[model samples]
Target: MSKLLARIAGYLSNRTLVGVDKLGNRYFTRTEEIDGIMKEKRCVIFKGEGDPTSISVEWICWLNGQRKRAPTAEEQMELEARREPVKQNVAFLKQEEEERRAKEGSSHKAKSTGKTGGPDLKSFIHQFPTEGNKLEEESDAVDRGRGEDEAGAQKAKEPLSE
Candidate 1:
């Protein structure tokens, strides 16, 4: 098929027919995975006679045939053991990141509080003006001066109202 020929050409530069007859041309076979299913199919490459790609395809098929199935239980356990180092490395990196964040957070709080060694929340609150104290001071000052000037002027103008 045209699709098969294109696929084969991608993996090879030159190809040659191992045999041919009146029925159909049977080129040398090469194995490839088709939709996760490994299969061997005849390849047609456009190169001239005595192309080396055919021999390469034969070796590829041989290698495919030599591949075995998945590993057994003991082999799977061995693979899991091999992954422990990677897991430990990831955990160490995470711990280092957490420590770095904690350090940065403490330093930022200390800067906001104007503290040298560490953050002090009580000292930071002392910098702000309290609404209750300010209001009380304003009200007392207004009450003490209320109507004093008017009282003085009225007393000076009255001619002994008694």
Candidate 2:
């Protein structure tokens, strides 16, 4: 009876089932001439009782003529494979950020006890040059600043002018 009804409704004129989705929605196609150009009319019969909005976007694309045919199982698998790596990378970055925050917090706690074991060093420790136990400033033989005693001696050595 359903076959007779479908035939009467013109939906069965040249319709052929092409694919079915995971949710069991059935896709169909019909070839016809429209304005002298051969075209395929694609559509779907959704499974079970529900709103038509539940139809998957891939199926929608086929039905709307955006895609040549229903998406294949292999295509779905490829999409999943491509997405897995990105998901893993995002999770890895999140874990690394959490570890950095935890290390920073622990360093703050260690400072209160004055234990000189961890990464606690003055910020400017590396700002100046050093060789062995001496810094570049201490090793300089020339006192470029000119001490008070040197200024007084130089002034006394100068001849008095009229």
Candidate 3:
């Protein structure tokens, strides 16, 4: 009971109200001597049911010590105001994309003749030489060119060898 009383007294004395979020959640900080060194502790008192998702990014940063100071109400309001336009732009872009896709889909459906069979592979193959023969012929031609060049070089060297 004495320990509980001491803890209550400590909290009442040391805890400092840092800020309140838009959701009515309260943020606080307190300094305590631990291991003979002063350390600051931060915490939040949720407005209602303690849903952590209710916290904003700025407050989360402050709570996590990523930010040295809590965000001001004006800063929060300004950020929220800025976010509104971005949200509208994103919604507009999504709607535009959906409209474009719908147009493309309708056009495709109109153009597509219901004749649904696989593509004419025979006609495609006819557009090029027989694959096996073409590859072998190309390799043979390359080898022949290299052999002729090597023979010519050897012939030129033979005269110099004399």
Clashes of each: 0, 0, 0
TM for every model, in the order presented, reads: 0.26, 0.39, 0.53
Superposition TM-score, candidate 1 onto the true structure: 0.26
Q: Which ten residues in a row have the lowest lDDT in candidate 2?
A: 136-145
**Candidate 3 segments exceeding 4 Å error:** 1-13, 105-162
Best by lDDT: 3
| Best-to-worst lDDT order | 3, 2, 1
Q: Tell me the tens digit of each residue's lDDT in model 2 across 31-141.
A: 899999998888788789755787767778888888875799787567767878999999999999889878988888533566557785566777665667556566453
Candidate 1 local lDDT, 6-45, one digit each (tens) = 8888568433344432223244555678899987655433
Candidate 1 ranges beyond 4 A from true positions: 1-68, 109-162
Better of 1 and 3 by TM-score: 3
Candidate 2: residue pairs that collide: none
Identify the candidate with maximal TM-score. Answer: 3
Total backbone collisions, model 1: 0
